[model samples]
Target chain A: MAIRSSLWLEYQIEANWTSPVIFILYNTLKPVGGSLLLLAMYYVVTGGFLGGEGLYFLYIGNAFYMLVAQTLFSVGWIIHDDREHYQTMKYLYISPLSYFTYLMGRSAMRFLLSLLPLSVLIGLGILLKIPYRIEILLLIGTFFLGWIFVISAGLLLSGVNMLTARHGNSIGQAFSGIFYLFSGVVFPIHVLPGWASTAALGLPSTYWFSLVRRSVLGKEVDSIMSGFTTGDVAVRLIIISVLFFVISYLTFRLADYLARKKGIIDMSTTY
Target chain B: MNVMLNLRALKGRAYPRMIGAVREPSWMFWDTFLPILSMAAYIYVYRSLDAPKEFEGFVVLGGVMTTYWMNVLWGMASQLYWEKETANLQLYLAAPMSKMSILAGMALGGMFSTSVRCISIILIGIVIFKVEFVVTSVGLLLGIFGVTLVALYGMGMVFASLFLMWGREAWHLNMIMEEPIYFLSGYSFPVKALGSLSAFATVIPFTLGLDAMRQLTFPSMAAQWGLVSPHLELGILLVMSITLLYVARLSLDRMERMGRSKGTLTMRWQ
Candidate 1:
């Protein structure tokens, strides 16, 4: 883990310039930035600053949605990219350490690296007169757990891709889009009909967004989930993180071994 | 005499790329689901609005229309981009076929796979979501789809041309143009809800496509106002698609002449 972490930190200092990374950042900025612009346009269109009562909620919700969604998705994208490029995976295969340690460190660094896009979103939120501050430890803890869970999920997907080697650049991107719908990222999960709402209910990301909405906007989610206390929420997330690591490691180790047997490890990184 | 032989060789080359693209389940799976899932999200979200609005059925068609064109355009454009970076592109180029024949293979594969998804989504929306469908004329709905297919794929060639020239930078920037516009164009939301001054109508194709779709969804809106003109929108998109495709073709011609693809993995901080 130590060696892997050190290598990844050095590696990320370099990956920070890729166009997709920039693309992700650009996409992050547009929604919040565009919303603030829409606020201006709303004034132009409706002839008022605070056009309607719910628009503020929409702004705050969308902004919070943007932060959690982007961070989680970026984590997935980074880890997926690692598997695709096989840059990390190369070292990961030959590392003098447990694969879990290697996977965790890579995921951790990528998870932290994903925070780059949020800077602009945070700036846009503050600029727009919406409340978008990080509330210290709890906010940090929420982000940490959320990012950890997301990265672990990414690691698990990485393991699958390790075997199949049938990687799609957009899997991370697509998974995020799919999850965004559920995790109250783009639209509130509350608004989703029974099947999708129930489908989203099973994901840890939904809970992550719940905590974000609570910490940021303090909106009541009574309409969404019932009888889940704050303490239960924390417990559930920790369990999710653990579940991800334990299960993913097994799949990853098996895939690693199989890929080696088949000599797929030496394959070109292009696809 | 040589031209006849070249045509046969072209057939030999282009046929595989088409069949192979379809045979790959991954391509078809995404084509099937991505559009439906995207449309389903809108259908899911709009339930919160006040029930008096008759926007649901109209909006669903627009959402489906947006998905259809997006798949055709984005799919076809990206196929070229994918072929470029990956080693397979060289393989395709090295084949004995003419470039246009090869491109036709790509366009056909993409369109066939995506249309399956589009039609399936419309069915799911109607069946699962209970989205209302009153077919005054299946002919009109089919007409919109026809125009959308030609315009979208033609414009896709236009987008693909830029990729052939400038590479990833143009490709990334161009992709952003597809989805964000859907929202602005009033695919999911009502044009009435778009505020009186939001001249999205003046600028975008969805405005016209959505109007044609709305004719099927809410004929009264079309019958009464005529302010929401379907023919005008379709005509504009048709012209725009041709113009975009023409520009794209020119760009591709230049790119093929240049023949420079730097496949370097630039180190960038994430």
Candidate 2:
């Protein structure tokens, strides 16, 4: 019930500002613009429009990575959105509802919001003649796992933001920017420097993208984890995602305790 | 038309942005660090493709201009919307000063911090990527850059008024503009690569500015990669600078009237 209510609330907050047609236009154009940006880069670098396997690798990797970028950013920023913008964080906390569930609900909305753009990118990929051999069960399983991992990380960020000042608002984008570099979103991670590639392995997002590409492309077309089988990648993704979930729960608990003790739960950064 | 009073208004508005740039040391860290990450990623992409060394230089220059583009969007364009949300818009509206002066002040203040970040990114690109440049005319380069800032911030001033006239759509519009502008402006590559689309991109002041800079900085690639002659780009930027500032003034006056009549000058959270 809490999840449903928060989801509705989020929809209203997101949609009420503009007409439906304009809203859809805004949502679609932004992501398509982002993908086209990558396509333009690939076109310039490779001197091929979209026929090469490299373009497909980058196109698909970038598309799926949007899920992480948007969902994680939306969830991570909910603290400031509620406290500073809406000025309702304190009231929600005092209610008899688990804030964790509420956050998950918000994450759910963001995940849904990202889908239109994700689908548009995939369609664009298909039009570009990128061969997609999807294994449905594999794609669904990998997606849910990836979603879990992103939400967990977002919750952790939200907890940290609760403790920090408003100046830390860009932390979400900064983290996403880090992932964009390390996780082989637009390029292969092995192409990264030795130290950077080593750092890439430490992030679950690296494997998540690997598996997602595997499920859609029917093979590890281009990945740092090419040596590892699908089973190995899945296991690694599961373990790290579960690890992130546990750590996030503990961090939120601690942050909640500290925020309450510090009496900054309703702290408004904007005067 | 008291010039002295408006100049003070400009100074008053610019003072906080300039101070805030350095006051929060962490902002500098993220500002430089994130762009460097992006710059490094593009450099690696070019390296992976075995593209020419000049391509990396293009990315470096693009990275530098990207700082200014972002500052224009977030620091100048949407600044009024942020102020409105923070309850500062009412005070500004009530003041007896030119809105153009306030925006001009923001543009100047934003330049101070963006300049710091741009220099940082350029220096890091030199050390980390071993990027090189060939500058035949320092005067021409500075001239293009100056005109570009004028035109870019002039457009930003127009956006400032439009953003305040709307409500929450301003945030969405800003969010939607970022990657699109980067793509359209060819922030990480030569705009000519976009082919005929590059003509449409000229409406954005930085596209030509970046292309002109790349041509000057990498003269060898200029013939092959130059979108158009640098002199032509310079002339366009100069024209754009005058046209956009005039439009900015007209838009600010019109939007201020609309906002006041619509009772949206102080509306929050809508």
Candidate 3:
């Protein structure tokens, strides 16, 4: 079952990349390049103690924050695109395959695919002379948390997409905008005034950035919940992740129930 | 008769779009809300921290003005891109009027419509946040407004043309502008945080427009304007706007020729 689903995910990804949608897909990465160029300019102007190499502390914190930040941006569209292309929601319901398994496989493939630009840009960071010890274990630890946050959010959204379909993409895009604004990606959460900071704190992406900042800049975590050890954050992340994952699964079931109630789950993405 | 005819077309063009604009409340609300939230979020955060009222007021107003400026200018530039790809351009081109009139009509109409959002922000800022209007230097403010508007729309036309010539790479460029321009504008943070190493950060129109608006609101800041305005800031906005307008027209003209030949060209993008 795993092998079959993995292969199916591969086929979907290959198809997405082989056509005009590649431009649309890469449009999702537009910020990564701009972020690179912006950081370069920032270093050039603010160099040393104030701006340059001395400020690498803030840079690492913010950059790592933005990576998960970018992931949370439009990754929900993995299924939205699938639904649009194949009207696959209905097909999923009727098929013998498990819905979560299928979607997870597809997301895993896309998660890898989306990371390509980020990996390249990470190398570009080295080219930019942003130094780091390159702690793989710590990196993967945070990446796992980020991935869990993102995948769960995407699932809930994908479940929403199962209902909204093509229009679901718009809703997903809207969340992406909100994510950029609220997440401490572009600016520090502490910089925000009052209510905005409260609202931002609720987003898991904020916590993901907190973790990423801790991992990358070797910065101390500020939030009590944020300062947990890798195993600690992971455990908490898993508990919260399970809730979201369950919510999404149950939401998809609700979506399926409603679709079955309405007689639309059988329809393909072509509509 | 020719002048009168174009004038009539312009009036007709502007009014219909103005009415059509309000029909899409979701887009309007969001286009306004996204920037407002971004700015408001900061204001709320700062107030929570008990930051000085003056500094908060200044950043909030700067954000409001900068956000509106970006939306208007970007909307103008992206009109064609939006219109063309969705296959809506063809329908507009086929309308019974001059293409230039229609293009001008769309551009003017967009400017007038979105300006309503800007005005609303100003009112909200004054009422809720006590962002003083500082109308003490209306004449200077007017001059600044004129320069800022001209610079914004002109560069917008330039970016709008990118869609015609480049098709989709135009979007790539547009997306790139979103974050970098915000920082360069110095809407949230002090100008010093931009770092002194590069003058390039100071010159973007977004930063210039914010500087002008800031000075206008607090006319006393006119002396300190030198800190923000180093002349190159003025030059870049001026030079870029005119040059971009010219480039945009050239690109459109090339499109015109090709479109005429192909006999399947659509109206210029919105």
Q: Itemize residue pairs with steric clashes in candidate 2.
A: none
Model 3 lDDT at residue A120: 53
User: Which residues of candidate 3, in runs, are more than 4 Å off?
Assistant: A1-58, A68-135, A152-174, A177-201, A223-232, A245-271, B1-21, B40-62, B65-74, B108-113, B116-136, B183-204, B218-247, B262-270
Judging by lDDT, tell me the better candidate of 1 and 2. Answer: 2
The DockQ scores of all candidates, in the order shown, are 0.20, 0.49, 0.12
For model 1, residues A1-271, the per-residue Cα lDDT tens digits are 4756744753454344356657565555435443443343233234455434334444544555444443443444443344443346566557777655654565555455446545565565554565544456667788778766676666666665555433233444444556556665545666776787788767777777666656665443436643566667677768866786678667777877787788776454332
Q: Rank the candidates by TM-score, best first.
A: 2, 1, 3
lDDT of 3 by residue, A1-271 (tens): 8546754764554343335566445533554534543454343334433334323533454455445434443445555444443346566656787777776666565555556556655665665566555656777877777777666766776666555433112244344546555765545565554686788766766666556655665553343334456566555556766776778678877875675687655433211
Chain B: TM-scores of all predictions = 0.75, 0.98, 0.77
lDDT of 1 by residue, B1-270 (tens): 356655665555446444645444554443456435645554544454333234456556765666655654455565566556444566655666555555555566555555566677778777777766665667766676566566666666766655555544543454355445554555654554456533654355455666666776666555632335666656776786677667666766665666645432121211
Best model number under DockQ: 2
lDDT of 2 by residue, A120-199 (tens): 88887778999999999999998898888888888888888777655433456656777788887778888888999999
User: How accurate locally is residue A251 in candidate 3, as Cα lDDT from 0 to 100?
Assistant: 85
TM-score (chain A only) for the predictions, listed in order: 0.72, 0.94, 0.74
Off by over 4 Å in 1: A1-61, A64-119, A122-134, A163-169, A184-201, A224-226, A257-271, B1-31, B51-54, B69-74, B90-97, B191-207, B220-228, B260-270
TM per candidate: 0.77, 0.94, 0.68
